[model samples]
Target: MTVADVQLFVTSAVGGAMVGETVEGIARYPINLRYPQSWRDSPQALRQLPILTPMKQQITLADVADVKVSTGPSMLKTENARPTSWIYIDARDRDMVSVVHDLQKAIAEKVQLKPGTSVAFSGQFELLERANHKLKLMVPMTLMIIFVLLYLAFRRVGEALLIISSVPFALVGGIWLLWWMGFHLSVATGTGFIALAGVAAEFGVVMLMYLRHAIEAEPSLNNPQTFSEQKLDEALYHGRGPARAPESDDGGGDYRWSAADSVWNGSRFRGDEPDCRADDWRHDHRAFAIAVYYPGGI
Candidate 1:
C-alpha cells in the first residue's frame, strides 16, 4: 500500500470516529469510537495497530512506520523569524522606573550573553523613555512660547518674566500634594505641571491687569511724586471701578482684593519690618496676589 493509504487507515482508527452520533430525546451527542484504552496504552500498542490495504491484505503499523515517544516543543514562537523567549515583570508598591532600574542593574551584574545574543527592554518603560526625550525638547519650547505670548499681550519683558517666574510657586503645592499621596513623577504629572504653569501665568496676567486698571483709574497713583506706599496700598484695596464690578460676583475680584489685603497686613503687622517704599510694596502685592490666585486653576 501507498504511504497515504497507511496514514489514512491509522489516523481514522486512532483519531476517533467522525460520523457517529447519538440521539437522546431531542438532544444530539457526538460519538468518538476508538480502540479500548487497554489495547492502546503505550507506544508498542500503537505500533502494533493494524492497517488494511487496497488488496485486502492486513499489515501492522510498525511494518511501515516508526512509532516512539520523543521530547520537543508542542508550539514554537518566533520574533523576526528568530526563536524568542519572553520574561514578564509586574511591579507592585513601587514605581516602574525604579523597579526597571533595579532589574537592569541586577541583570547586568548577574547575566552574561553569548555572541549574537542581546537583551532589550520594552513596554511602558519604553514609552516613558520616549516621552521623557520628547519632553526635554517640548518643555523649554512650551515655556518660551508662553513667555512670547505674555510678552505679546503686555509688550513688556519684565512683566512677561514676572509671570513666568510665578509658575514655580504655583507648582509647589501640587508637588507637595503628589509627595503626600506617594506619587512618582511621570508623563501624566509633567503634562499637569505644564497646564499648571499656563494657569499660573494667566492668574499673574489678571493680577497685573487689576493693578494697572486701579492705578490708571486714579490719576494720583500714576504720578511718581504723589505716589506713597500707604496711598498705593489704600488704592489697591479700594480700587473698584467698572472692571472690578463684574468680577466681584465671580469670586476672583474678592480673592484678588483679599490677597492684596493679606500682603498689606503682613507688612503692616510686622514689628521688625523694614521701611520699604511703594515699589517694594507693589512687588510684594503682586507676589501675594499670584500665590493666592494660582490655586483657583487647580
Candidate 2:
C-alpha cells in the first residue's frame, strides 16, 4: 500500500477520532474506526494486519517494512538549527572562577568535539565576566570623579592628590584582610572597596585640615623660610590638646583647640594638660584614625 494510505488508515484507526457528528436534541458523538485492543496488542499482531494494494492484491504489513521496538530521546532539542545536548555541573568548596577555569582546562585537554561542534560556558561565570568588565571601567571613572571633587574642595592639586593617594592604602589594607580570610574578589567586595575609598578620602581631608590649622596658629611655622621640624612639632602638640577642660562643679567648662576632637568627641590628653616635650599627639592621631576608620580594630 502507499505511505499516505497507511498513514490515513493508521491515524483514523489508532490515533483518535477522525471527526464528530451532532444529532438534534442530543450531544455530539465521535466517529472512530479502530480494531479491538486484543487484535493489535503486539508487534507480531501488527505485522499480521491486512493491506490491499492498488492491484487488488492482499498482503500483510510485514511485506512492506520491518517492525520492531527501539530506544531514542523522548523529545528532540535543537539550538541554532543544530541538535544540542546539555550537561549541568555544581561546584562545592571552591570559588566559581577557579572551578570554571579548571573545568575549561580539563575539557580542552580531554573532550574531543566532532566537526562543526562547539561548546559555551554560561550562567554565573558569564555574569561574573560581564561585571568584571564593567568594574574595570567604573573603578577608574569613580577615582577620577573623586579627584575632581577633592580638588574643588581644597583648591590645591597637591592636597587633592594627597587625599586621593590614601585610597590605595585603604585598598591595600582591604585586600590584605580578604587574603587573610581566604575570600575571593567579587562584585560585593569591589563595591566595598569603592566605599572604602570615600571613607579614606574623608579622613585624609580632616587630617589635612587640622594640620593646616595647626600651622596657621603659629606665625613662625606658617612661613616656609622659618618652618622647622621642631616648630612644626610644637604646633601639632598644642593643636591636638584636649577639646574641653574638665567640667567644674558649677556645670561650666573651658574649650581647648584639639585636632583629635575633630574626629572623636570629648577626647582628652593623658592628664589635665598635654606634655609638650612628649610626642603624644602622633600616637593619639594614629589611634584616633584607626578607631574611627576601623571600629573593628583592624
Q: Highest TM-score: give the candidate number.
A: 1
The clash count of every prediction, one per candidate, is 0, 0
List, residue by residue over 1-298, the lDDT tens digit for candidate 2: 6788877656655555646565667666666657777657888987887777789888877888587989988778897899977777777756688898998899899999889998877788888889999999998999899999999998999778876765665456556545555556766667656755675566566556655687788898767898898887766655444211111111121112232333354334322122211112322333344323321111
The TM-score that candidate 1 achieves is 0.62
lDDT of 1 by residue, 1-298 (tens): 8888877776668777677888999999998877677656889999888777788888888999999999987778687887877678788777678899998898899999888777777888899899999999988998999999999999989778877877777666556555655656777667756765675576677666766676677777778988787776665665423333443333344345545654777867332222112222233333455645433321
| Local distance difference test, candidate 1 | 0.67
Query: What TM-score goes with each of the models?
Result: 0.62, 0.59
| Per-residue lDDT value at 251 in model 2 | 13
Given candidate 1, what's the lDDT at residue 125?
Answer: 88
